[model samples]
Target: MKEIVIGENQAGQRFDKYLSKYLNEAPKSFLYKMLRKKNITLNGKKATGSEKLKEQDIVRLFLSEETIDKFSQVKVERSHGKLSILYEDKHIAAVNKPSGMLSQKASGSDVSLVEYLTGYLLESGQMKEEDFRCFHPGICNRLDRNTSGIVIAGKTLAGLQEMNEAFKLRSLKKEYLALVEGVVSSGAYLKGYLHKDEKCNKVVVEKEPFEGSVPIETEYRPLAGNQRVTLLNIHLVTGRSHQIRSHLASIGHPVIGDGKYGSKKSNQLFCDSYGVKSQLLHAYRLTMPELKGELNYLSHKVLTAPIPSDMKRVLEGEHIEESIHE
Candidate 1:
């Protein structure tokens, strides 16, 4: 027999949902069965599946001790590698994932950021494979293959749910810095729908879709501009596949070194003259509400990845400053 008391954070959630976080080893069927048999009670009374819980509700469970022991034996195994940890708490970890690394395991790849992170947590002794039975860790959002910057992963199931909700509600904000060819109007807003061609691995911007296309909106402002290139700050109001790339290209200011949506001539010129390799884009900042009240105001973090060597060379040749901001 065990007693569980709900906290403020756990309030207003379903009973089965709450139990799932704590008794990770127990399947949903088992939980419902226990509830049917009166083995689970709230405030000393039997609970129904439809019962809405309030703050400070007390739940009690009657189960054999042996079952609990079996759950303790379950372990989660992981593999690790070089990763930069930007922020961490008991519930979540935020990292600055580098380019060329898959966020999760792809069809053919063996090593991924998730696998690396699991190994990191295990090696650091913050968690054991067995502990994972009670908590499933996973990345909440994704970045492109070559785009780099802050990526968040949940260390616990509760954290994952919370962060996922935050994203869905648009309570989380992300900002990016991109270098595009040609100059853009100051404080210009670009809006359009994007259709991705999987066969060609490119996104096409159109005012209307032929059949299967999604709506995407991207707002960009020219932070700095010169005769040849413009640096813009991009905010994605609606995240769709290749929204930024496709929208920017539609406006005739394709990003520098973007072979797919940009001019091949410009890409070759930059690569040959400056030795630049991937598109010049970086996730610059992220903001989210604090999980705990002690940190009251919205928590905002800024991340800066120095311009790649190839891009730096071009900027140096152009005599640009080390830092450029609006």
Candidate 2:
């Protein structure tokens, strides 16, 4: 048997939910049965999963040690390379993920940012396998494999839960910088519906809704440009797979170097000139609103990842500065 004292972060959460995180190997039906049989108790009394937790409340978990380890310990091959950290705190961390790295995983052997961050915590001794025996720290957001930017990771359960809520509600704002083909003289708000083709790993943008289509909103302001290309600051109001690339292509301004949605001639020109293979887009900036209670430390702050070298060269050749912020 093990006892846990609810802290501010754990306070106000449902009792059953807390137990599920602790004894994850056990099923919900088993947990409910345990509660009914007085095996798992709240403050030394029988309780239901719906009981609202409070600070100083005591929770007793009555599972064997082996069972707990089976559910909580997920062994990952620790990455040896260094990570570019943007921001970090006791509850959370934000890192600059490179363009080629997988946010999670693409295959069984693939190493991911999630696994790396977990390994980071363990290496730093901030957490251990035993600590994760209940809850594990992880990235709260994801970036496409080829798109690089600020990736926020949760170091604690409260941080993870709060970050999930923030993203789900779109309270957390993200901004990206991209180089698109053609000169966009002015800014515009673009709204459309999109349908994704899973097999081809592509999307079709439509002016109207369709059977599998989902509504999307994108806003952009031209930062700098020349006749052949425009550098942009993009705000993704609704994030979907390939939303930016397809939407811009639908408007005849596909992102440069994007072979999927962009012109083959343009792609060939860039490849021949600069060896630019991936789309010239980067999720380089982020902003957060005022947060209360446990996550208050991150309130009203901004995070940024420096532009990659390839994109920088493109902007430079166009005679544009590194960036423009408003």
Candidate 3:
């Protein structure tokens, strides 16, 4: 027999949902069957799997160790990479994720930023290995594999839920810095419809809506530039796959080194000059909204990540530093 006590992370969710996460390999039908047979009980009584779990609630499972082991999938491999932390608190953390790091795993063996966060928490004695049974700290936002910048992580279940809600509501404002081809003389608020081609992993922005297309909004201001290139601060009003790159391209200002949506000749020029092989885009800033509860400390706060060395070199070479703010 196994007894699972609901903790902070495990509570506030449906019993069936919790069961699925705990016994990941077990089928929903099998879990329902076990519940019906009284093999799974809540607080010493048979449960219907529809009950809401609360902290300190006891869940008893009348099953053998072998059965439990066969159903649960628990694999923890600590990441060795050192994280560049921007800000951290008991509920959440913000880190500067460099280019070429995955926000989450693409495969079972892949190590991502989430793993690094886990490793950091463990080494700092902020978490225990056993604590992963119910909840694990993880990134709430993601950046492209080649794009570098700020990433937010939730250290506790409440933090995760609240942060996720804020992002979904678009309450948190996000900004990016991009070095692009051609000069942007002024700021503009651009709106368009976007259609994504999944097979090609690219998107097209159009002035008119197409079938299956979604509306997108992007705003940008020119920080500094010359005739050949420009540095711009981009405000991502509506986050979508490749929105910034594709939208800017539509305006004849494709981001340098963005092979997917940029000019090959321009990309080669920057590649040879700056050794920049990926999109020269960085998630620069995040402005917190009026938040409540545990995350209220971050309310109305603005977080920024410094310009990467590679991008900075290009700006310096272009002599645009005089017009840039900070």
Clashes of each: 3, 1, 0
Per-candidate local distance difference test:
0.72, 0.84, 0.89
Residue pairs of candidate 3 with colliding backbone atoms: none
The 10-residue segment of model 3 with minimum total lDDT is: 317-326
Per lDDT, what order, best first? Answer: 3, 2, 1
Q: Evaluate model 2: give its TM-score.
A: 0.85
> Counting only residues 3 or more apart in sequence or on different chains, how many pairs clash (N, Cα, C under 3 Å) in candidate 3?
0
Clashes of 2: 1
Native-referenced Cα lDDT, model 3: 0.89
TM-score order of candidates, top first? 3, 2, 1
Off by over 4 Å in 1: 1-77, 289-313, 322-326
Q: What is the per-residue lDDT of model 3 for residues 1-326, given as tens digits with 9 covering 90 to 100?
A: 99888988888999999998888899999999999999999999989999999999999989999999999877666787689999888888989999889989988988899999999998999988777766778888888888999999999987898888888888999999999899788999999999999988889999999998999999999987888998899999998889999999999999999999999999999889888889989998999999987778889998889898888888888777734354
lDDT per residue, candidate 2, 1-326, as tens digits? 87788765567779988777766667899889989988788999999789999989988877676766665444445666678898888888999988889999778889999888878888888876656544667888888787888899988778888888888888878899989999899999999999999999999999999999999999999988888999999998888889999999999999998979999999888878877888888988889877885888889789988998888877777677655578
As for TM-score, the candidate ahead, 2 or 3, is 3
TM-score, candidate 3, is 0.88
CA shift of 110, model 3, Å: 4.0
